[model samples]
Structures are given as C-alpha cells and as structure tokens.
Target: MDTWRQIIADDEKSWVLFEHGTCVVLTTPGDDLAAQAVSVLRDSGPVHPGTPAADFGTVPLETTPGWVITSHHPDVLTYVSPEEIAQDGDNTPLAAGLYGRSKRDQDAHSLTVIHVEDNRR
Candidate 1:
C-alpha cells in the first residue's frame, strides 16, 4: 500500500484517510475509529470479509472524484490568500496564492507559491 494513501491519525486526534488526491475525515470521536482504521490498514494482506473488526465503521470501497469530507476544523492543509495575510498592515494583493503550512504542524511557519488547480466542478 502506498504510504500517502494509507489511513493515518490526523494531527488533531482524528483519522485521515486518503484516496487518489482527496482526503477523507472520519469523525470518530475519541479516536476509536481512527485506531481501528489504522490497525486494518497496517495489517498484511487484502481487506476482506473478516478483516475489519465486526464493530468497525464503514470503510469506503471507492473514492468519489472531486469529493471532499467537510469539516470546520482545519486538518493538515489549509488555503490562504494575500488578503488573509497579516504582515504589511496594508490590504494589497501580495500573491496569486500563498500555500502555507497548517497551524497544526509542529513548526508551522512557511509559505510556498505554486499553481493551484480547481478540481471541483
């Protein structure tokens, strides 16, 4: 299994599952589902009839293109523009788009400029 595509614990005590380039947030409070998902993911062999725990929550069999699991709380990635910047005290457009680390990161203070494509239709 690809490391990036594997289900991992979100920095904010939730489960983060990735399929394709989209991320899925399984809102299993108290990390219950996240733990189970991680166990299943780390186990050897394919996911089958009896692989997942009987009480385990639903596992998506396929990913919907251009779909996002919405949440008010930011995960590992967040988007921002020049208008949201807080340095110059002036509201000028400083960049086309500034990609910055999510505040949740351990050392969260970096920005990179890159072309962003809107996959949503």
Candidate 2:
C-alpha cells in the first residue's frame, strides 16, 4: 500500500476516491521488468502489513466451508454459489479491472471491482 508508505511533506484529509473499485492484490503480477523494483522494495520493506500473519509461510489459517490445500503443491481455490452471492449482497468482493502503471511492467496482480458506499467521513 504505497499510499501508506509515501512520506508527504504536507497533506490534508481528502478522500482518495476509488471510483474504479476494490482490488485483490495478489502475491505477484509476473513481469521480468518489475524484478528490479520488486527486489528494491523487498529489500527496503519494513512496511507493516497490518495483517495478523508475520510472514507468507505463516499466513493465518481460517477454515471456510470450501477450501483445500494439496499436499504436493498446496494450491487453493474457493467456490461461491448463487445463494452465497445473494447473501453477500453488496458486500461481496469481485474483480473490476486490470491496469499497469508502467507500460513495461505490472508490479502486482489485483482483482478490482466497483462498489457503492458513503465515504462521508
């Protein structure tokens, strides 16, 4: 979350409206051009993830009704049904876009989706 990393000299609380939607940032977007930037950020990272897990290997375990980890490769995919979707209502997270900041690279992959909410803070 570069929004949290940047050191701004001056700022005021103004909404950084995400008209585009939400993004599910994956572990990586896969681009050789981003290798250098990734390495740099990886080396410089003291960035607090805020997530409960301390590291990737120790990702907090949560049991959802639809989940399984393979012994050979440990892959995961969840299945959601129409009933679940209806229950989720407007709170469900779904992809909305795929964008690359630099033409040469995509830093990471993310699932983006547009949502409606009152940001009147």
Q: What's the C-alpha lDDT at position 59 in model 2?
A: 21
lDDT of 2 by residue, 25-114 (tens): 223333432343234323322223443111222121133321111111121112222333355353222310001111001212222112
Tell me how many residue pairs clash in candidate 2: 2
Q: Residues 29-80, candidate 1: write the lDDT tens digits.
A: 4334434433333331122333321111112213321112212222322223
**Residue pair clashes in candidate 2:** 21-113, 96-112
Strongest candidate by TM-score: 1
Each prediction's total of clashing residue pairs, residues at least 3 apart in sequence or on different chains, is: 0, 2
C-alpha TM-score for every candidate: 0.19, 0.17
- Please name the candidate that would achieve the greatest lDDT relative to the true structure: 1
TM-score of 1: 0.19
